[model samples]
Target: MSTSFTHIFNGDSTAEAYAHSGLEGQEFVWREMVVQGPSKGIPGQESFFGPRRTYFQKELGMSAESYYSLTEEEWHRMAGASRRGEWVLWYEYDVFCQFNLIALLAGIHYWDNPPDRLSLICVGEDENHRWNTLANFSPDQYPKLLDTRKGLTHDDLLYAATVWEAFIQKAPLGLLPFAQTPHPSFPYLGLAIGYYLRQFPQAHNGLNTLEDILLQEIAQSPKTQPQLIRQVLLQRNHPFGFGDLQWMWYMKKLQPLWLQEDDHLSLTNLGKKVLEGDTVYREHLAGRHFGGATALDYIWEEDREEIRPFPEK
Candidate 1:
């Protein structure tokens, strides 16, 4: 009832890390993998969450009730109990958190009592430019991060809301302009757009950026699950914000292109061809939704710097 600010953390990990920071305010720990499923529609609403529900159930084995309780309930509860104070969003610079960030920004516009003041604490690298996470930092370091929080103005949120709507509508070309010059309130916004665009299937091989990277790593040698994950995470060219659970799902979808022997995985001949651009991986793949569009709805060519529509066969 008497707090100066409300803190919105990216997930449980970030929240847990700052629980003892001695800051007094309402704490909202965001819970959702916005990067893994259909991201269209008004966030926090079940209507737009149908595809996400199935995605989680099939890929992560999470039940509908579990998903609802984990996401919508917490999201709504936070807004319902919102106090009149500066709302601070603690996120990461990676695409995963950025995806959630924009969606949350857009969703806030529909809240019965939206935040009067919006601020953000986003961390990705330290002074030496070393990659780090909130959880990776010691508890004492939280205050320093809090001190660097950037306040977002009304125009900033408006832009973010617009971007989310455009993304959900599957008009990606409209978003390309922002990938280079993002709004000042969110410097990472443009970077997030670039990162996400890279994930679209390549025009040549039909393999997405991350998938191609995975295949290349696998081709180096038969790799145990842990080794592969570790290598991917450490690679400088690794997909920004791509996580273990997402990789697991990708492996499941790409089983046909890989040979799994016991705990190790190696690329099959099909995988080699797909990786090399000799095969169109998407042709053999099942339909997959990304936000409002299916996987094959567009092809992103890195060299061409374009995301053009791909005619479905």
Candidate 2:
């Protein structure tokens, strides 16, 4: 799908309001809306977008109109969408979804404004998951924060974390710690790491892996389902099927707190926690040879090169 979608400017009122407010200049491609009120339509041929508005609103906290007024036609011309802008936004929305930090923070701070204050939320590259999460949240604490003075609670954080990861998995690393790629192994590795960290909540020194974690001297004792997954992965060094097996076992039998899909895989609330826990750091600590000659590496090797030579001794 195109990174650009139906210009969600909605009605003229919302369009004009948001256009004047601060959204128009933020690299948002605007087009004529069909079906009038809140119609979901793609951007039209006459659409326009630029970055001047984005920088003004984001960095200066200026209103959209105030920011736009500063720009002459020349400035606006410079701000127009380019391939670079599209790529950057796409990475933020499509691949890593870190760009929604703006909206999420705004939603979190919605109460700072008057009770009836409405802000225009933009669509980043990862509109699918981002929009879905927003729709789910709109009915909950966010609107309530606007209606009342109450702040978000732990449950809200949990929900937000899930929503955060669902999009963040596609976002950039600077926006979030973990960057999910289209690679199949990437998410699988993520799921494994998430499972491990949830169980061994305590911080430990030195390099660690699913195998190291499972066979640890401390792991023999009983653990939560989250911990079990980690321990199993860290302790066992088996065939490629083992990874899938463990994933299936936990996702199928465990019934974790995170959301599940029909594919028999699940994403847990603790994913963000794991993301924050420095999986990359841990990977770095584990050294290049930590995983050893595992089945997982074998498949990756086969895919990268037809010959599956064993690792250098």
Candidate 3:
């Protein structure tokens, strides 16, 4: 009885993809977080409609012919699907300020330095315990900056930095997964593996058995190798040949990432390192590890809505 957690970004075909992936007995949940607000100044007073297409026309300098050529419905579906997944819908104001506060804290930890914008630098920390100093500050508290709450301390920031890295590392690759242009997949994969390592500090030295680690990842996700391969191929929009592109990347490479020739695909010491947060890319493959130590390597915001990690904070 093993359980795996995932967060699906609400705005994409994530649900459909996973639903169609052919993995058995996968339980799913869904939630919504608004990210944008409606437009203003309309006869219906509807915030949903944009002010006008005039701005887009002016900005792009589209001619009458070009303007008419735009596929409004196609564009609308794409935009609407994406918007459906947000966990928070915010306007120019501060109603949904807590998560924004969290994002600011996360950003500071990400950049490893104070931000240039004051509004963004609301969270801080130190060596001891991290504190959302900005959590409860009222406007009257600080008239100087005109903002409330302070930043995180040094220890707090360091801890947060570590956690922030892990958080982004675990998030789904999103457009990066389908990006056929610059090929950001390798780097993104590296970051994800690195974060997985960070998540499980206990498995740092348990690399002697790669097979066990790879098995562990599969056990958690409850997907077989063929199923995994099929999912990847389907996502890529490639032909599902017997062994077309499969031999090139999916079968040998990604599979070997966790498994070895001795048996099936397994985890390696290097794989453990990637899962533990040391960070390694596909091209820079030196050592690999697999076994029960292989953690979930990929995730998305939409999948996460249903299967969530234990809340650490």
Q: Pick by TM-score: which candidate is best?
A: 1
Give all candidates' CA lDDT scores.
Answer: 0.78, 0.28, 0.29
Winner on TM-score (1 vs 3): 1
What would the TM-scores of all predictions be? Answer: 0.92, 0.18, 0.20
Give the CA lDDT, 0 to 100, for residue 290 in model 2: 11
lDDT of 3 at 110: 39
- Over 80-115, each residue of candidate 2 has an lDDT whose tens digit, in order, gives 423221211111111112212222322233222221
Write candidate 3's Cα lDDT for 11-79 as tens digits.
123334434444323222121111111112211112212322332344334443443334233223322
What's the CA RMSD for each of the models? 2.2, 20.3, 20.6
Better of 1 and 2 by TM-score: 1
Number of the predicted model whose lDDT against the real structure is largest: 1
Query: Tens digit of lDDT per residue, candidate 1, span 86-156?
Result: 89999887888888888888888666667878899887767897766676777778888888999887677
